[model samples]
Target: MAEGDAGSDQRQNEEIEAMAAIYGEEWCVIDDCAKIFCIRISDDIDDPKWTLCLQVMLPNEYPGTAPPIYQLNAPWLQGQERADLSNSLEEIYIQNIGESILYLWVEKIRDVLIQKSQMTEPGPDVKKKTEEEDIECEDDLILACQPENPVKALDFDVSENRTIEIEELPPIDHGIPITDRRSTFQAHLAPVVCPKQVKMVLAKLYENKKIASATHNIYAYRIYCEDKQTFLQDCEDDGETAAGGRLLHLMEILNVKNVMVVVSRWYGGILLGPDRFKHINNCARNILVEKNYTSSPEESSKTLGKNKKCSWSDGLSENPGVSICSYVLK
Candidate 1:
């Protein structure tokens, strides 16, 4: 190996060692090849229920001429939130090219997680303390600490905590039934407030005997928490691999919030390969268009089909066997 290449490899190994030490064994996950490193991180240190897993692969010339490739994964992270973090990571690498950037990347992600946590969590006390109030509190503390006279402390009773109940909204099932070959795709849409609601909606859909038998009940959701003022988005591939992520990405691009889209596919015994992804996205997009959730007046008027029959010939070959027929549920 050339001297320059050898030096680059040594530096990369040193950086990896430093990362392992800083993150510890439990938090850091390294692949067998030692080329890929992943760290499990959380927005809140106190609670790690929701976490972001960051993984990076160092190329042969890393920190010398090539940049490390990285990906961020989280159950409830999608849309602009995911894009922003990715962009920041790339910017960090670009600004500090040919330098040890693993540490900087980790710290930058930590800062973003903290900021996101603060936004999602409740803010601190609204009332501000005046200088006079601070002085009074200090004097009280000093008086209480004196040994000459016993401080008379007030006893307070513990109050019972009351739980506030949230009403459950019924799931909305709307879709455009599309068929390609022997496969059938029925897309369903519903408004969801929290992750729990997303689960509930999926459960309700699975309850239907017709939907339960489908080979893949792929789904994606984008919800906005009014209380936290933060966006929550997620996707599940079911048995369709990356189909769920693609659907979720489409929803994010459309700026759809507080909505979940599920595409149930009854496999026709034929493997569609990449074509399945196209069909899945089209099914979900048709529902969004019909509900007017992602369409503007001008765009809708121009794009809306006259006979309610949407065709894919514009993008596909002349003999594409797919057909999308939309239906809006009252």
Candidate 2:
């Protein structure tokens, strides 16, 4: 190897070892050869109210000319908050262009979380609520001791209580449908910047008779929040068990933000076993790649080779080429 490559390798090793020592169990290596790793960070080490996982993939030219690609995983994070955090990371990379900056990035996120937690301190209102709950508990205990009057159970009809009407639907992109053992799976993609848009997409998709009739509609979405410097994301199984989680993991792996993907499965009364999940993920990945949410294998290799610089414009961009993934239980 050339001298520059050797130096870069050494620096990477040192940084990895140092981070492991500092973070201990929270630091984990995902792919040693590919230089991919993840670290769990929290606002407070002993008593954490909010936490997130940061995954980073170091390119070969890292610490010399390239920045380590990264992603933040936090389901509660959303909107302008995620955008602001990502932009800050890009700015840090720009400011420290030829140095190992993993520690800097970790601390920056931690600091932000701390600040957020401080702003929402538990005060008199919280104390009052706790006291009220205690009084309710005491009253319930007293009632339990008295058998003079039998307690009557109350029933409520909740079928339409939580309905959210869809006012409009965003444009959706459909991937080529997949079929196996008489089962059909087709993935739908849409751009969403908030929870409201996410709900709208689902409502609109259900308006289509074919989609509504499907056996399962596993979906996942991620939206960046600028104010909180986090992401707001969620997934639903729709009776597919762990299928929703798997779809969400695929989107995370692609580093897809401000977007949602739904895979509708029409079961053909034939048992596919593990093959069902394979077909589901395949449909999702195909649509994500087709929609440019993630790069194809050929493009990924090329991206790694180039010394991609994040300019001011890049800081404002939502996609930064960082990715992570999750698993399905069903």
Candidate 3:
């Protein structure tokens, strides 16, 4: 590389590093490949529909190959511009680095740049709100995904004849179990409060509380993520179990601290055996970890929390330092 080219390349590397620190693992997907940075400008900024941002990263192959492609979902890139860009990418040969790749790269980049250049501007706070809140921030238009209004999956109800019906779907709830609880030894999780620890925190907080208790053949617990109004059904349990330690062990693996997982086991006529209890608890814990409630709460409280959105690591610099995702479920 020429001296000047080397100097520019080095400069770009340094800048990407800074971004990586700010964005962490997620940064790799958007930051430099050949050292070119594209500023993601969201054209709209008021009440966004989904998270929107400009993604700048060089395609795997470059230079003599195709130039880096622009992931322009900017507020302005919607509508016709979006369609055109979408069509352009459908060209099979243009997918990766290859002969005259730079031409195609620059060509697409040019198209996007021209479109973006003409787009409107977002407010000064767009950057702070979107990345910090994990909400989409736009330059001139708003494209965010608030939990209160998430992008729903296509609405379709199952039928014997199978005719798709598009309409509102009801929230899922397994409902209270119907059975007897006489000899049933009910083990309840105390109300546990954890900042980041997902499993133990919530359950620990609700451990001693008898507020939500019942006797039946079914056992159930909730997984509280950062977002309360979402994925509430991620928790799991069986109506019967002889031992609940397996559930306790699974909690250890997740290092989840804040939210609670309340497992209320009911008595069943026939015992499923002790091994079954371990397996059942294990299953429940896995469901909680998989459900991923840590960030869920943060997301739900996004607009409500005002300005407290932050990564798990951010806690280190602040009052409570980040630690091993530890688990201590009682």
Candidate 4:
């Protein structure tokens, strides 16, 4: 054979090897109605509070045949969807909940990809899918989640590689400084760090400082001392997301205003499971402890209290993410 023919043969071998690594050994195509092809959730998955996602595609030699697929493999899917992953795999199909979810997913992707290819008068490299769909009404469709590939795909596995459990939300702070009412609290108010009545008293000083403690996480949050009439008026309107009602309820129960506390957390990967919670509580508690809250004797203090708040930022934005919460004190 000529040198050119040998060089072409070598390139073809390299291409086949690369495809095999990605799609695995056995590859197939879709025949009839859409079915599942494969399913894959992240190896980094954790909880309902957070989850992961992924995508699958068909091999180049697709329809005349259909596309391949993939989806999440979970107990809920097996119990709820009554799915058959193997069947989808056999038919080059995909689904979401289980095996079927995988089949639909892969075929959907393949259909769209191929449809785009067949366009005779392809306009720009970046054509809107809708514009393409208007013309090429083919048999398969892209996934509902198809638009956002490279979006936040999750890896559910929590083994040493992925995210480990940190503190759950609604952190507890055992260390709160207490003193005889005479020295501070000149405003004749209650001090609470919740979604309610009290806030951090920036104006007052415990040891002649800016009434601040480096220990608190949700630093300087406060509630106003408004009565029922004003409660509905000047105070912040309640919100389900921002949790005004919860804060207000706490303030009403405490009967104080204009002070808040901070809460912080450290990720403590599954320490038998209990350790993460314990570590979070301890971390917050340590702040209070550093401020001489827990270890201080009752006789040394006029009063004692605990405050809880979470700082879950919105996963995708500047907002805090999910912070599940509950609190208890003695």
Q: Report per-prediction Cα RMSD to one decimal.
A: 27.9, 23.9, 22.6, 28.9
lDDT of 4 by residue, 1-330 (tens): 766445434332222222222233123322212322332322111211111222244322232122333344333334422234334333232111111122233333333334434643432233122322112211211101122222121222112332223211122222322212111111112234333222112222222222232221223233332332122101221111222222222222222233333322211232223222222222233343344332212111111111222222212112122222211111
Q: What is the lDDT, from 0 to 100, of the residue 267 in candidate 4?
A: 18
Looking at model 1, residue 141 earns an lDDT score of 12
1-330 in candidate 3: lDDT tens per residue?
676456434433333333332233334343234444544323333332223344544433332233444455445456875666555543422332122222232234444554454664432344334444232222221112122332222222222242223212212111121122222232223222232223322222223233124332223222334564221222333343322223432332233333344444433455545433433343344334445532332232232222222333233111222222211111
Query: Considering summed lDDT, which 10 consecutive residues are worst modelled in model 4?
Result: 179-188
lDDT of 4: 0.26
TM-score of 3: 0.21
**Candidate 1 — which residues are off by over 4 angstroms?**
1-167, 226-229, 295-330
Tens-digit per-residue lDDT, 164-204, candidate 2: 34323457777767767667888888888756667656766
lDDT of 1 by residue, 223-281 (tens): 75555444566788888886776776566445567788989888888888766776777
Per-candidate TM-scores read 0.41, 0.42, 0.21, 0.17
lDDT of 1 at 136: 13
Worst 10 contiguous positions by lDDT, candidate 2: 135-144
